[model samples]
Target: TVIDGVTNTTTTVTAGTNPNAIAVNPVTNKVYVANLNSNDVTVIDGTTNATTTVTAGTLPYAIAVNPVTNKVYVANFGSNNVTVIDGATNTTTTVAAGTSPVAIAVNPVTNKVYVANQISNNVTVIDGVTNTPTIVTVGTSPYAIAVNPVTNKVYVANQLSYNVTVIDVASNTTTTVTTGKRHNAIAVHPVTNKVYVTNQNSTNVTVIDGVTNTPTIVTTGKSPYAIAVNPVTNKVYVANYFSDNVTTVIDGVTNTTTTVTAGTNPNAIAVNPVTNKVYVANSGSDNVTVISPSIDTALPLTTAVTSSSLVNVAGISNATVSSAPAFTFTATSTYAPTAPAIRTVYYQVDSASGPWIQASGAGPFTATLPAQSKGDHVLYAFAVDGLEGGATAGSSGEGSGNSPMVGSVAAFAFSVIDPLAQIITFGANPGPVNYSPSGTFTVSATGGASGNAVSFTSTTTGVCTISGTTVTMVTAGTCTIAANQAGNTDFTAAAQVTQSITINPILPCTPGNFSATGNAPCTPAPAGSFVPTAGATAAIACAIGSYQPNSGSISCTLASVGFFVPLTASTSQTPCPLGSTTLITGASACLNLPLLNIDNSDPATVYDANTDAVLLTRYLLGYRNADLIANARGTGANLRDAAQIETHLSTYIPTNQALSPFDVDGDGVVLPMTDGLMILRRLLNPNALNVMTAAEQSAITANAKRGSLTDAQVLQRIEALKP
Candidate 1:
């Protein structure tokens, strides 16, 4: 539905499916509508009712027309591409764009187009002459875009990062300007070089100074979305979607605003600088509301300042009040309205940017504002009359849409004095602290402004913990303490002050203890055991080759060579006895010397053939067998043996009188012809030459054990029998 401004009548012009955004070319008198679902554009001829359907990229979201260049641009969100159409021929060129292109704006003077890519977090700058694209990086989630043709600068609003990216056309370099959280829409006034951005999440507007790139916050109604600018009047129009049928008009000169009644859910807004009129598209009511400011706002002239001078809400004629004052208004309009000039009085604290409260009644109407903040404040207000077709009402409280009247902006200033000054004081800094013991702190406060009693807290949670005024160090680092005192009725609240505290770290464990993670408290090794490494748990014992005489030692000593430690954890090593010895270290037992058990007839040191052999021969003949081994001539023959000769009777080899202790050789028989004869021959000859055959000189018997025995073997058995 299109409304004729002159006739005040409506006409229906058919468009493509789900038509969302519209743009117009004043030079050609052409209108373009972007159809999101149909993936095309519906072009309407302004002179005639003719319509043309032109194909575009998928899900076309935003459209902008360059009247000077006679070109139109559409940003396709789904296709990640841009559709550019020639206004003269309706021919379109598909240009590749960044991912998820959401908004597009053009600079007609420079003939350049900029598309904001939300997902890619960058912008694609397109040259109108060639349709070529250049990607310029931006902040995260770029949602809206606008351009200043005069300065040749492009601005992109990043919703997630809460900042605006300003791109210089000459250098392509960007400067970031911070804004409120989750900003969705932006508008730039070319003449003032000021940018207006609507932040939906924060319910405010961020006004950016183009020269300094500085941002100043302007309060707005809930969820402000669409924005437009009228450079001629220096006014910025903002559509407050959740604010319930209202739009805030901001003065670029003073940053002050006046709320005029609009339509339900007044979302999309635009202005005509040529006519100085503003138009708003109401989504909920499905109609367009035209607002004519009628020369500096249709303000009713008041005769005199009535009780509680209520003109400016700043309406108080620049008067300052100490308390909340009651207001009464009486005024007349120039156009001669159907009702009183001042039918209702609407005002808001601080600025005219509302949530405005209204007082609608007959002449001498009176109203009072609720409790206000204590500081310099301006009360902005406007009056609406019963004149037909003046302004629309954004809310039911705005009365009839017949006459839209806000009073002449008079400066209203007021001050509320505070009774007491409350502050929190913390003692001097307590330098660095050890991690071992916790520290205690004291605080003093004047409670009314600071709030409640004095309380302590730690800002660095990972480094320290605080309970009341006590601080416990958790690790090595810096610890900051914040002291707060919530105020009472006499004061508002005191600002929080802080102090710095340092925490020293703990040391590592020493040797002779098992301390894991390098903490304190080391353990000692067990008795007769030792540990080699610091912070070790395992204990090493003394082995056969090594010993540790003390406990809690780092190492053990090796046993000396020829000495031995037989058991584990032994304090000392033992040495071998007289007859038995060990040649190596760590021996468990010593070996005895080999026993020489020869000398059957004599226990004496020396032996000869004369006396010892004669006794042995006679004894072997079986005469007095007991005296055979009991020979007096040879010192009781073999009374003791070699192994324990002197004292050990158990180890003595006793004389065997049955035959002979030795048969001169290892043969079984002890006959005179064999053993006895061999002993006699050896003892009698001594070094004499043998006078016998080889068979007779052989071991004296045919037995293999006797006959194979050499003379040295037979003599060695009888202790080398010789005279």
Candidate 2:
């Protein structure tokens, strides 16, 4: 039969006949039952409630499980041997034991098994992996065994010797502590390393501290035969077979015991630490009794702050300036039979000795603490449940709550920090300012309350900004940075202190200036020199292909062919015009060349007389007599000779005569002798050719017979005939 701790419901599963001992594997949730009469072990799946049986040594009296390996160990009293069952395979192996082995225990961490030989008064240690046995001598009639995997120690209860034997697993050595006579069961709390032994004869439990190996007898129900402990809660449970009740011992700094009713003849006890529930196997009742530790009124579910919003204070002195921070404490009352509800929460400061102040509402409730003098302080909080009769004042430090339900308490320790004293002083003032790289200054409060926060502000924000105690330069200007601290109630505010900071401008690099290294400003170099970066001690002359036209330029500009700056500090110059040449450096303008009436047969070659004649003949042949007539008629000018008349009448003239092509002087006239003679003179001396306009001359030069001719080439031909 298995009971759900949460719902208090029971479910039964069929097993082999006369099951004497039962153990659970928490990892797999499988239960192993030792059937003494059937001489087999019944395995029950907790989830499915399915049963499977495996043959074991005769008269199996006790069973234990190693959750880590999923192995089951059964003590066979009649056969004097132990059965090891593999939970995965449902197979068993038998190992010989001394006399009748009645109790078994396993250390999952070390995979070691301990079996108590009742008649032989010894314990058999079997290596779970190797299945090898090592016999260790104990007290007379060892009945029960328990192992603490963390400490690697084994404890056995010797019924006849009236003592408990503690064996060190590493050394295989035994130490005996006198306990009540007829010790039937043993259990250990791993966290506290405390050993608990249930005495059937004395009807009490002997608590042995593993550290000191000392025993403290705690009274329990009549004929207590089985014991178990919850390391999480540090609670020990003892099952009394005669009284049909179990004793619960709160293993605190001082042990406290309470009794809870159980089924008849409770012979074995086990605890599920996860649920804090104790299960007692009753032989007389032929059923298992489930005890919820939460329902024990004598041991009220301790009140603990499940969650909190308060920041824990490390030391006594708190340095908060804002109103003392409010703290919200949420407390949960332990489960009890009556479903205990928290009625009121009490708090006290400095000492727990005084009358406790009750909170207004049920928690989680918020409470504000009064400001305290600078020193150590303690705050204690606890909740009283409805089951408690009422709050009762007591002279002792302990507060009494209503009957049946007790209160749980928690304490906090902290100190209030003294107010900061006021004194203003600057640690560093502004030093000399430099240009290129900006400068920095620092300011600090010298004598202020410890932990007092200080703020910094800059009067001239545009020039500089202050962060914390440091002032950084922004631009070229003077700014004042101030440090201020606002004191708390304990200390007066410090006077604001101000310091002035000046930021210098970055110097411009000169044309002939250069920086050899970083940081330093560029210095003047020799004339006609320059550099690319700042901090130069010497300057470099402009490279052959580059020049500097302006001062203070970091680099030089490439020299344009037509104009140049040859000397140091040279500034302005004019570019060479068309039809001129400037071949040397620093020439203001291009030099003009002489023109000649030469033919430019090959435009690629220099102008000569032959190319000039070709150009004249082409222009002459393209001219028409009609152009001369139209020019004369539109401008009302005379046509001079027979040749002029003949040229003018050669082509058809428009009735309006709006077009004029014979305006050789571009004076808007067509005097044939003047224009025609001008053409003849130009052919002989092209420089005298005013008949052609600049546009006409440019066109002719562009469409020269040899090829396209440049302005310089046409100018050379035109200037060659100049007087």
* TM-score list, all predictions: 0.42, 0.42
Candidate maximizing lDDT: 1
Cα TM-score of candidate 1: 0.42
Candidate 2, run of 10 with poorest lDDT: 651-660
Could you tell me which 10 consecutive residues in candidate 1 have the lowest summed lDDT?
309-318
Clash counts for all predictions: 21, 31
- lDDT at residue 606 of model 1 (Cα atoms): 41
Across 315-382, the per-residue lDDT of candidate 1 in tens digits comes to 11233233465555555555544445456656665543437677545765556767643333444555
Runs in model 1 deviating more than 4 A are 296-723
Global Cα lDDT for candidate 1: 0.68
* lDDT score for residue 507 of model 1: 54
After superposition, which runs of candidate 2 have C-alpha atoms over 4 Å from their true positions? 286-288, 294-723
Q: Give per-residue CA lDDT, model 2, range 497-562, as digits (tens).
A: 887766666655544465554333555654455655555556666655456665555666654544
